[model samples]
Target: MSANCSWRSSCGRAVWRSSRSSSCSSRRPGAARPGRTDLASVPNGQAPVLPRTTRLFQGRVHAASITHIKPPSVRAAVPRRPAPEPEPSGAEPPLVATDRLRKTYRSGDLETEALRGVDLAIRQGERVAIMGPSGCGKTTLLNCLSGLEDPTSGTVRIQGTDLYALGDRERTRFRARMMGFVFQSFNLLPVLTAAENVELPLLVTGVRSRSAREQALEALRLVGLSERAEHTPAELSGGEQQRVAIARSLVHDPPIVWADEPTGNLDSENSQDIMALIERLNAETQKTFVIVTHDPDIAGRCHRTIRMASGQVVPEPVTPRAKGRARAAEAKR
Candidate 1:
């Protein structure tokens, strides 16, 4: 409490020397205090140093202004958002589309070209049949269009998403969410019952068990196999198994369905029945159907047939009935 108090600073540096008669511990209301010790002041364009026991605050230290003493609160930084997917530039993009689509398989330079620049477009809710002779890239085209196989040198867009551009896991998830596939082999697990087989797709998508079961039962009923829901694949006949597969395909309620010779293993009666069921379902659901088949009878039932040969779409042959029908439609118009 001395009248002449000075800091015993090292290096013989004296920052402040208040020549006041009053002591600092007992100062009046308007008494003079020390100078430039607060962070807001910067005299001589330089920061002043204080006592060793005193706290050093930031003001104009060197060149940059620092506000280190009881600074105002600032909001936490928010992360930047990711860029959105580039939307397809069209009034309505095709449900399934391909441009210059090609697929080739190579086993140590033993190459086999399965698809050659196949340009295809299927609109939403259209039942389109793809018919071709054996080994004519029907299955390969189906696989490419449905995102099951990647084409070597072309693009496949499903619902405006680039199929190959997605990673494997993302593409698989996209397929599980947006597509349904029915194969010729009736690829049902032997241990699972018909209902279990039907619900597998829904279950994979994180649908609740009760909801998945209800949807599976509804899909089975749609395919006319509700009564046989408890039967295993071995217990069901070939036709019934295929119906179960069809039920499984539809269980997820996807917008597009792909069938690769779905009735190839069934008898003629069963094939007819299955095709009839498919036609009815297509009418009811208004879902896009892309069926790969060689049977003329099955191809004849669709809205139009796309014939493939040598990995290319050949022109469809116009039958006389088609000409007559076109003329009749023209007359009606």
Candidate 2:
């Protein structure tokens, strides 16, 4: 009975040893855990003692990894830019306009009113001839309209902007950009060639030298003087020189061209040539021409004519003599 009892005790000890060995083998490297089948084994002495729940283990892993990961680079937000403004339309309203324009000068005890409430509308693409005898405010009205001199009491608008309110520099810039002038004197620089003389206005308006020369060549060609592009005023004939002056007026492609006595210095043949060139340019380019002249034939050839006498535009009188002359002139033309 004692031998049988000792043998039973030894068998029980062997069973406990086998169960502990099996448990230790299940937790060995690369072996499955008790509740987590997907959990991978770590290196020797580096295995983590994580919580039994999957969520807690994952959360702890994420928290630990965040310390090693760098923060994302931050950048300043940029602002969106606004769109540009639209330009004004519809022919830009004539480039020049006058409303009851008046100009009077007082010298000591003498008083002379050059312009007396002149109401005028000079639109784009229209050729106009202001014809009258001498000393009738043609030059005075031009000066006022060009912003070279302000009216005594009136308003003048250029490119739909008020000119009388502008200061001297602004007025000068406006003139350079929006207007061109020609005169009988052929205001060419004595030292410059024909192309250079034509480019003067572009230089004033800030056109680069290369582009200004190209534009000057084009202006000369438009006036049928491409061959004389290098000639000086002294080298050219009176007609050719006047054409050069006209080209100079057109170099910047100004919207308004005002010519005062453009052909007064030329003979009849030269006058006819200059007038024909002006007419052609007006027809081809649709540029506005406001010519002040004493020549009735030149005025009659224009599309519209305004007769100014004593600072007032005298209406065409409905008389038999005037009617007969008009009919005769029409027949001749």
Candidate 3:
């Protein structure tokens, strides 16, 4: 029996020879000592057995974890939308009101109601004509609207500012700054030249003479009378004088132009010419016009016509000319 054998390998089983003397007491046949392999064989016929295998040299095993992550990608910044477009500079504002504007006149004991609650609105750049027979308040309405006469009742406004609230001096200044007048009669001065007649309004406003003359010439040029600038109104024809009058009205570049029978005294040929000129100015310059006339032909030429009868505005059917003009404009569009 080898007592000092190392327990190194799996086969390091203890081997023991039975004691040489059978009398050697208490000795097992294959019993191993402590810190050594078990080699004991039972005397009651027990056989040697091996111990079971276990995880002695193996390292610890951990559960695997799974996590989700997103990858980076290319992105662009979105552009902001542009703001909505603004209204045009010379455009008319929408109608705010059409009130009962009236007027009354008393001649000694006889009373005349020139207007019976006339409800109307004159927007910026609106071309409107006042048409009717005599005593229809056409001129009276024009006078009130142009701030030349005060209304008996009701109100009139320009861009929401009441015209009647202004004092006489203030009203005069306002008229010079905001209105242009064209009378039925050729109101030109016989003494002043065409340019000088055109410069009257500016002169009244106290503009410098040189500047007034310059503006007057330009206005005459617009009416195609630049060649006749030095000629007096008496020297010019009826049409030319009317053009000079128009030039005078335009000298101040007022927003509104009030024509009280501008062509009432002119023949048809000259009347057509004047209407054509007015139409051109309305289309090109976008100036507001309120023309008074007794001619349906003249009224037809305007964008809108309000017919008056016995001091009251009466509704009328649209003329063929207006229909034709509307259709032509549509076709052009």
Q: What Cα-based lDDT does every candidate model obtain?
A: 0.81, 0.75, 0.77
Which pairs clash (backbone N, Cα, C closer than 3 Å) in model 2? none
Candidate 2 on 104-207: residue-level lDDT in tens? Answer: 88999998988888888877777788887788888888788877788899899877899988888888887887888999798888789999999888887789
Full ranking by lDDT: 1, 3, 2
lDDT leader: 1
What lDDT is obtained when candidate 3 is compared to the true structure?
Answer: 0.77
Candidate 3: Cα lDDT at 307: 87
Q: Residue by residue across 85-181, what tens digits does model 3's lDDT show?
A: 9878865553222358889888999988998898877666667889888888999998888889998998878767677889999988888888889
**TM-score for each of the candidates:** 0.69, 0.67, 0.69
TM-score of 2: 0.67
How high is the lDDT of residue 63 in model 3?
23
Write the residue-wise lDDT of candidate 1 on 185-261 in tens digits: 99999999999999988887799999999999999999998899999999999999999999999988899999999
Model 3 poorest ten-residue lDDT run: 65-74
RMSD of 1: 15.4
Window of ten residues with lowest summed lDDT in model 2 = 1-10
Shift in Å, residue 115, candidate 2 = 0.9
